[model samples]
Target: MTETLLILGAGQAGAQAVLSLRQQGFAGRLMLIGGEPFLPYQRPPLSKAFLSGALPRERLLIKPENFYRQADVECILDIPAVSLDTAERRLTLADDRQLPFDQLLLATGGRPRQLQCPGADHPRLHYLRTLGDVERLREHFLPGARLIVIGAGYIGLEVAAVAVKHGLKVQVLEAAPRVLARVTGAEVSDFFARVHAEAGVEIHCDTGVVGIDGGADTARVHTAAGDVMEADVVLAGIGLLPNVELAEAAGVACENGILVDDLARSSVPGILAAGDCSNHPSAIYGRRLRLESVQNAIEQAKTAAATMAGKHRPYTQVPWFWSDQYDLKLQTAGILQGHDRALVRGDPRSRSFAVFYLHENRLLAVDAINRPAEFIAARTLIPAGGRLDPARLTDESVAPQQFA
Candidate 1:
């Protein structure tokens, strides 16, 4: 009997797994299941180009519809896997169909963390997590509309930038003291705050939305400061929660996310997890991390595929991510945890600089603002674990090559 491999979630990780398996000479029965009706597509562009109407719907697809058929990968779209039975090696779909498999990969991804306050269910309140969500929100982006964005993170800031370009009055409310506080340092946060402010985005840092009021035509955001700001549309961009319920229900280990090894293997034999849903140990960072970036998802899927094909390759690529807001591009590499100091090279005022996070002369991470060359060079230096002189790193006269 030919062995059957079942993949859940059909997002970037699931689709990549199918491709990687074929490339690695795994000719077994391949099946991918996704909750969304459409084929696997890119999510990053939904907030920027796609939301701005600059990118068409067809461009969002990762592969043409025929690619799945050509690859001989069976795709079951618009239905979700309701439950998983690791003991029986069976998965129960929403329609009560049980599918058995020799091996399984969970790439369920994540869902947006919704606002819990009262009136959050109002018709005008919006959250962007899927293509459908963005399409619905796009209709409200008329010129001169009032957009009240809740959260100072990438999604909120990106949406604000897009709204500003469309001639909308934007107000961003961040619960934290500064923008991008959770991911970036104070210097980087302040720099982004200035950039967004200069783009006509009203950023209210240290402000929390207590509740929302009103209906379809408008919304009034009640803040922790006893102030109410009305909006034509309100967007909640707090963050995401990993889709690990299936893994947890199957008795698989889960901590914050589905616990997986370097090879994306779960505690249960023949079961693996990847993408935003899995939290795996990082050989570079020496800790368990659940990254939501497309880079992490694709790399982890390849690792899972290789391991399932009996190659046992580990996922050790240095993690990297990027964000676009207005005319600025922010690129980040490596995990910035445990960094004691940061060195800035170039002028933040000019909007072209790189901030290097170091620990006792060792590079840990790099955040480059509109400096792709420096970002690319820092990616290599980080994984190389090479020591650098702080003075030379910060010196504007020195090029990035000198550090090598």
Candidate 2:
């Protein structure tokens, strides 16, 4: 009898798994389920190109409709998997439909973390996580509108950049001491704060929102610093909460995300988890990580698919990510956390440079600002985990290719 593999969540990982399982010659009864109505689409561009009117909605799809039909994969869309029974290997959809599987892949991804303050449920307040969310927010992106953004993370900053460019008066409120404090060093964060300031974005770090008072026309945001700011619209991008409730309900192990091994196998046999909803062990980092990036989703799904296809490929890909803001491209390779030292390679005053993160002289990560060559080189160097000369890293005369 042919095995049936059911994949939940039609985001990047689910869609990638569908394509990869076929590529790996699974030839099983493959089915992909998504809660959203549309096909699997890219979420990264939702705040940047898609929100700015530069890219159309059609271009966001991971794979066209014909690809699924041609590959003989079954797609159940717009219906969420409401419950899971690991013992029975069955999933129940929101519409009361039951489906059994020989193996399962959980890729439910994550949802935006909303503010807990009062009046947050007001229609004027927004969170950018889905296509519908962005579309709704875009309706209020009028020129001369007062837009108050809460959180200084990538999503908030990206929205601020686009709003400022669209002629809206934008203000960003971050509870942290500095913008991008959680991800980058002080130098990188300071540089971006300067960039946004010059671009007409008002950034208020060390400011915490206490409550929101929403009226028919505008909303007033009260901060902990004893100040209230009114805005025509409010957008929050605080963080993400992984979609692991279904797995947890079914007795699957979960912490920050669904627990999985390096090969993407979960605590339950014949079941795997990947993407933003999975916290898998990283052999290189020697710790478990739950990454919320497109790279992690794609690569981890490939590993999950390979395992289901009877292949023995371990997932040890050096994670990489990129963000675009006001003509600035920040490409990062590896995880910079826990690095003992950070070195700058070019002049930030010139608007192009790279920050190399080292731990005990070993190259751990690199944040390349408008520097693609170094970013590419860092992707290769990080996996090798080799020690490098600190003097040569900061030398502008030396090229990235020579680092290896």
Evaluated with lDDT, which candidate comes out highest? 2
TM-score of each: 0.98, 0.99
Candidate 1 collision pairs: none
lDDT of 1 by residue, 319-341 (tens): 99999998889999987889999
lDDT per residue, candidate 2, 1-404, as tens digits? Answer: 99999999999999999999999998879999999998899999999999999999999999999999999989999999999998899999999999999999999999999899888887789999999999999999999999999999999999999999999999999999999888888889999999999999999999999999968679999999999999999999999999999999899999999999999999999999999999988877889899999999999999999999989878999988999999999999889899999999998988899999999988888999999999999988887888899998898888889986
Clashes of 2: 0
Total backbone collisions for each predicted model: 0, 0
CA-only RMSD, every prediction: 0.9, 0.8
Candidate 2 deviant stretches above 4 angstroms = none
Q: Which residue pairs come into collision in candidate 2?
A: none
For each candidate, the alpha-carbon lDDT, in order, equals 0.92, 0.94
Measured on C-alpha atoms, candidate 2 has an lDDT of 0.94
